[model samples]
Target chain A: MTGHPHDHGHAHAPAAAEDGPPSEYARLGRAVREILVEKGILSAADVRRAIEAMDARGPHLGARMVARAWHDLAYKARLLADGTAAAAELGIEMGPTILKVVENTAAVHNLIVCTLCSCYPRMVLGIPPDWYKSRPYRSRAVHEPRSVLAEFGTVIPDDVEVRVHDSTADLRYLVLPRRPAGTEGWSEAALASLVTRDSMIGVSLARSAHEPVETA
Target chain B: MSDTPLRRHHDMGGLPAGRVERADHVLAAWEKEVDALLVLLSRQGIIRVDELRRGIEALPPDAYDRLGYYERWIHSITAALVEKGVLTQAEVADRVATIAAREEAER
Candidate 1:
């Protein structure tokens, strides 16, 4: 009681209710769900299944797709034109999503985001991780990709160009990062070890197992 | 004869943004839910198997066919419903209207 102010000496009572009730995002999601059910576009069971599939096979499928694109050139071209067919080539079945792959080359660095909403390539790339849906990343990634990539520890040189793709159409995107050096004779599986999820999203470059993943 | 003063460029009215993030969020949630409902109803023997199959068949092939596993099956039902007239365009429009109206009322 002498020097500093006595702040919350009662061991800090439990926090009060949230400032404003449900967030806008939650409200919107609820309203949309109601509309979909009423319109016969969606059902409760469908949501459950989607959540399940997202947990089970989404990431593995994305990893496999990235691996395949790394090893094959002709297949990569095919993927660019038609992602669904390309995915099928690798025997990764497509349910109903028509995915599109966008390759990132020496000159162009491709980034993907759904400006309208989170229209990720779930069929191929899998359900986007939570970070992709965050407001700051979602809003800024498209507009300032290089800066974002830098934050992720993959800095593109001044000469390199950056192109951000907004996944609004039925098509989705996956970045085919340029092949890394010193791994000339490596097998496809070995090459695949380097294709991190962040790399596939064009936010960072792929790194070998030897190169430690930089903490965010 | 007097002439009317020219309208100020800054005074012109503006339309709202074409795309609404909140609306998209809701619609996406709805689409997923709708697709799942059809699948569940079909599995539960509530909706005819053939009818569900028909609905799935009605989805846009380019988009739906590329969907993975369950989603493919789900969208198929959406197509079938559209074809069977179980889910009509007018019905969808009406539902959207209702949601919009409710939102306006809340505001």
Candidate 2:
């Protein structure tokens, strides 16, 4: 077997678990991780490299794709037709799940939520937002998506149909948010700046061309 | 009236709930490690992501509600490792106690 896939320097120091300083889950996690390491099930570098790779994936990747869709109609069709291949075309590995890109149109607004235990397109978005994983969001996103969207300052008019996609472990969704008006002729890079993580998740709309970019 | 469809606590969807609080924070280092370990172990074919999900899903509602996202993952990951015979529960327990003692002595 490989070096205890878990053995090597723990990336962090020990603490308490459950209630005190550290969490019980935390201690158990560490203990379990160390034992595996000692067994050569996992190495320290394996753990570290895994984490580094995850950290490398960010919502920006999704933003870039959304921006590309806005820049090229053919790419948009491809994204909608086959998200996995399109992502591969862009050199983005989508991990194990199949990505489904839902486009937001003038009359149809799409929202993405994993009602079950926070399934998300983590391959590109890295970790999901805390709110996205909360019981409130998970429970309410499908039943009251408009309200949830309103909570995020995104109001959907009565005329527009709001569609919420419930993601599973094997299938994930990404929102191809409608490009803001007046962004015509904008370069793909510039357009990408307006595609906020929330926009890609359908919590918010893409920023207006005149608006300053979101820091996140 | 139609009978209410029963669902697991974690299977909540379209269920009446409170308002969503929109907030976010960076993942702590340990949480990231838990995530990484799960990924690495899955890559090594020692465990499957769905197995981790099952472990999380099987959590009693109280414990499920109590643990954070990564906390839940680590709990499930640890349990799965023990079940797979890849790591013994005794060793894990002893290591946890050892860690608890070290943390206590440091304080």
lDDT agreement of model 1 with the native: 0.57
Candidate 2 per-residue lDDT over residues A99-156, each given as its tens digit: 8999999999999998888989987687998999999999999998889999999999
Q: Is the docking of candidate 2 incorrect, acceptable, medium or high quality?
A: medium
lDDT (tens digit, per residue) of candidate 1 on A7-100: 2221222222321232333233334345555556555446566545544555556666776666777777787888888888878766645777
Report how far residue A167 has shifted in candidate 1, in Å.
1.1
Best by lDDT: 2
Model 2 per-residue lDDT tens digits across residues B3-105: 9976788999988888888778776666777888888889889889889999999999999998899999988888888788887778888999987776677
